[model samples]
Target: MVDVMHQEVVALENRRRLYTGLAVVLLIAVVMSGYHEASQLNSGGFLQGLAKFFDYPAQIVAQSWEDGWAFWALFPKFLPALIETLNIAAVATIIGALIATVLSLLSSRNLEVPAAMIPVVRRIMDVMRAFPELIIALFLIFVLGASPVPAAIAVAFHTSGALGKLFSEVNENIDVKPLEGLKATGSTWLQRVRFGVLPQVLPNYSSYFLLRFEINVRASAILGFVGAGGIGSELSRAIGWGAGNEIAALFLLLFLSIVAIDQLSSYLRRHFVGAESFG
Candidate 1:
């Protein structure tokens, strides 16, 4: 009986290995095929362009070094644009979190939402998340005539859907005792959630909101590339005019700004999540 069981285990192990090997091979083949197709569709082939990929960056860096003063000079010129990008991100995050808070409660199974409406609301969030922020920004830019307004709207729309899904999951893990206690006191649904659910999930919600703000900051800058009015638009124009020095300067500023925001957000998230875990 022991011999028979040992052989069966070996066979199962062999079959698992066989399946894993096949999956890996299939994944590699798919990746290669996708790369080949992308290269063919691209204006420049991958291998051909790969060699020159660093040429632009190299040139920009050398030019920046040669004219370091000019690089510093561009900061004052672009300060307002950077501020605009930050403002866009802040406003969008606030708006998105506000909307998401409501949607999350409605979508959460633990809440008292109508069963039939849950799927409908979830689908709406899915639609919002499905569309890329860039696509939304461009569409809004066409309608709104190219301003930070469109960028903010695009980021907010996506953020609400994304955060709503996360917030619902957080709601699922919350203690039901508070909710029941509130209900026994004749509290309305909204009152129960506000007094019970909000306290439990606020830290998690805040952590997500800060993360989204970091992402929206980057998105806002990218949206500016499409003429949404921010540093990105200026960077696009500078590149278009072949202003290598200015491009380098803008790149430096962008890099620094992103790093600063990333560090600050990371610190806040750690604190918030840590506090929630302790509580």
Candidate 2:
């Protein structure tokens, strides 16, 4: 018994030593990669870059919020733009969620589809989601011209891409028993999908849609950088014209709005998924 216990201790020590060595090697590799990138970006002047980041924001925020009340006082001025941004997010989320429902059914690998079309459809979705939201905003701006139209278009495209992928994942996680039961009922493909697949995945699908709505709210604010008119356009303009006070007002507004939207979305999702209902 003593010898057996001793052998177990030795084996445990060997595993610990092996793990420690691998961790050290991984740390060294990560550090080397970071150092290489930093060097390429002129790491010798890193101190100066760090100084600028804090200093610039400090100078701007300090002068802008001279009186705490000034920020709140400016809320009225931003209210209209804030509403517009919220509208963009709402419209985009609803429209995108609707479209994504269809595309997700097509894109789900577990669902039956013509074998020849699978790769083609999947690749198309991959390309759509692969592009960043801002890039899509820029492209929409060019196609639709500058206005809320472009911003909504960009937001819709972004929401569609993100929500579709999420929707597919939700579909993939569904319980398979309902599907088999529906099949045994002599149901057609459409009937099985409508009765069996949709019900099980609906809860998770709502959660994904609401979550993506939260992201779209934030993204639409920055769409203005690409000429997609929304609160982001106004925020960018405020910064451009050196209205630090206005920018401060916008920042406070953004924080409050996003927080409210997040809470509301969480409540709705939980309620819909039968976790809890609104109080």
Candidate 3:
């Protein structure tokens, strides 16, 4: 019996090794075929694009070096555009967080609600998250005549869905004792949620909101490229005119703003949510 068991174990190990090897081979084959197809479809072959990738950056740097004085001059010219982009992100994040709060509570299982409504609200959130912000912004730009307002609304719509799902997940894990105590007092649903749930989850919610704000700032810039109204629009114009010197300046400003925002949000998240949460 001992000999038979040892043989069976060896056979099982062999089969496991075989299966793992087959899986690795299949994955490699798939990756290679996908890369080949992509290269075939690309306007420039993969190797060709890779070789020329540094050419544009080299030109921009050379131009900026030659006309470095214009770099400082362009900063004031574009300051308002940067402010507009930040405004769009800030407004969108706030609006999205507010909407998410209501949806999250309604969708949370621990919270009291009509059973049918839960799936309805969840589906709405699903639809919201499924649409990309860029597509929404383009559609809105067509309707609303290309302003920051449309970009804000588009970003907020997507943010609401994204944050609502996260908020609901946070709600699911909160302490229940306070909620039970609130209910025992015959407290209203809103009262119970306000006093019981909000305190426990607010840190997590705020952390997520701050992260979303960082993302929306970048998204707002991209939306401006499509005619939304921000530094992106100005950047687009510079590119169209082949103003490499101006492009370098705009790039520098954008890069600095993004890094500053990232650091600030990271610090705030660590302070509010605890470092372990991010880890």
Candidate 4:
């Protein structure tokens, strides 16, 4: 009994040590990834390539606002624009979800494929996901002429790559029984996917779409800085002129909108997940 107890204690210690090592490695990986992204986003070469409207700190501080209360006055004006920003987010997410769903079945690991072409397709998806959405917006603004259309296209592409990847992962993890049953009944590959895959993943798909919409809401609000229309344009304009109150109101509205979204997304997620019942 004494020997068994000692061995159990040793095994527990080893498991704890292994978990600690894994946690440390994961933390390091996350930090490195964030640093790499920041470096890429701020690269001078990238800025030059995009020809983004530039801001100079010196020019900004040259303007004046003496009263703190003046900043608070600007929020009310941003309300309508904020709603427009949320609409852009919703519109982008809906369009992107449809585009991505089609791509996802093509990308799913479990899907029957022409063995040689899967990698080619996946690489295309990877390229789309690798660059930031803002970069896509920049290009769209260039080609599409800086309207909300460009902004929506940018969000759609970003969401497609991301949500497709997630959907593919979900596809891979689903129980094989339903899929096998379909195949057993002489179902074509497409039919197998239609019946087997869609049911299991719809909850997760909706959840991801909602999350993307939340991000897009924030993204749309700022797309205007690059001439892609949204409330972000006005907010950026106010900030440029040292209209601190307007900026504050815009930011506060953003905070409230995001908070509301966070709650709504949580409720929807739980409802879909069956953790909470929806009436």
Candidate 5:
């Protein structure tokens, strides 16, 4: 009996290894074929493009170095645009976080007031998340013309869906005792969620909100390239004119701003939500 059982285990192990090897081979074949097709479709091959990828950056650096003083001066000149980008990101994140809070509560199985609507609400969020911010910005810009308002709205729309999904997951893990206690006291649904649920989830919500804000900052800048009105628009113009020094300055500004926001948000998340939740 022992010999029979050992043989069965060995057979199963061999089958597992065989399946894994086949899967790996299939994955490699798919990757190689896809790469080959892409290289054929492109005017320039991957290796050829890769070789000259740094040429533009090298030129920008050389020019910026030659005009180091002007590159530094561009900071103050572009400060207003940077501020505009920050404002758009801040407004979008705040609006998105608020909407996400409500959507999350409604979709959470444990906290949902009308359980029947949970699926509907989840589908709505899924649709919202399916659309990228850039696509939404383009459509809005067509209707609204070039402006920061459209960019803010686009970011907020995407943010709501992204944060709603996360917030719902957080909602699912909360203790239900507080909600039950609140319900026993004749608290309304809204009251229960506000008093019972919000207190427990606010830390996680805030952490996610801060992270989304950092993402929105980058998104807003990118949207600006499409006439959404921000530092991205300025950067686009600089690139169009082939002003290497100006391009370098804008890149530097964007890099520094992103780093600063990332550092600040990381610290805030760690301090408020604990180190484990920082990610």
Candidate 6:
């Protein structure tokens, strides 16, 4: 009986290994084929482009070094645009997080009041998240006429969808006892969610919100390249005019701002969510 059982286990293990090996080979083949197609479509092929990848950076650095004083001077001139980008990100994150909170509660299976609205809310979030912020910004820019408003709206739309999905997943893991107890006392659905759900999930939600804000900051800048009116537009102009010194200065400002935001958000997330929560 032991020998028979051992043989069965060995056969199962072999079958699993066989399936895994085949899947890995298929993945590699797909990747190679995709890369080959992309290389063919690319103007100079992948290898040729890869060889010259550092040339632009080298030119920017050399020019910036030659005009070091001018590069430093660009910072003060560019400060307002940096502020505009930050403002867009901040507004988007705040508005989107608020919307996400409401949608999360409505979509969560455990906390949803209507039960039937789960699929509807989930699908709405899916649609919202499916469109990239850049695409939304471009469309809005055409209608809204190239301003930070379109960028903010675009980031906020995507943020709400992304955070709603995350927050709903967090909601699903909460203990049901508090909710049940609140319901037993004839508490309103809103009351139960406010007292029972919010406390348990606030830490995770805050962490996710901060992370999303960091992402939106970068998105806001990128959207500006499409004439959404922020630092990105300024950067695009510098590049178009071949102002290497200005480009370097703008890149420095963006890099510093992103690093500062990342550090601050990381600290806050750690404080709220705790390192152990991730483990």
Tell me each candidate's TM-score: 0.87, 0.79, 0.90, 0.72, 0.91, 0.86
- Candidate 5 local Cα displacement, residue 208, angstroms: 0.8
- Encode model 1's per-residue lDDT on 1-279: one tens digit a residue: 999999999999999999999999999999999999998899989899899999999988888889857679889888999999999999999999999988899998888889998999899999989998899998998898899999999999999999999998999899989999999999999899989999999989988999899999999999999998889999999999988888987888988999999888888888977854321
Weakest 10 consecutive residues, lDDT, candidate 5?
A: 270-279
- lDDT per residue for candidate 6 within 26-57, as digits (tens), equals 99999999999998898899899889999999
List clashing residue pairs in candidate 1.
none
Q: Which tens-of-lDDT digit does each residue in 1-279 have in candidate 5?
A: 999999999999999999999999999999999999999999999999999999999999999999967679889999999999999999999999999988898899998568789999999999989999999999999999999999999999999999999999999999999999999999998898889998999889988999999999999999999999889999999999999999999999999999999999999989878776555
TM-score: which candidate is best? 5
> Which prediction has more favorable TM-score, 4 or 5?
5
Query: On lDDT, who's better, 2 or 4?
Result: 2
Model 6: residue 195 alpha-carbon error in angstroms: 1.3
2 or 3, which is superior by lDDT?
Answer: 3
Q: State, as a TM-score between 0 and 1, how close model 4 is to the true structure.
A: 0.72
Q: Tell me the whole-model lDDT of each prediction, alpha carbons only.
A: 0.91, 0.81, 0.93, 0.78, 0.94, 0.93
lDDT tens per residue, model 4, 106-218: 77667776666667767777876897778889987777786788888888787878887877788778887998899989999888888998889888888888888888888
The count of backbone overlaps in candidate 5 is 0
Model 2 residue 184 CA deviation (Å) reads 4.0
The global Cα lDDT (0 to 1) of model 2 is 0.81
Question: For candidate 3, what is the lDDT?
Answer: 0.93
Question: Which regions of candidate 2 deviate over 4 angstroms?
Answer: 1-44, 276-279
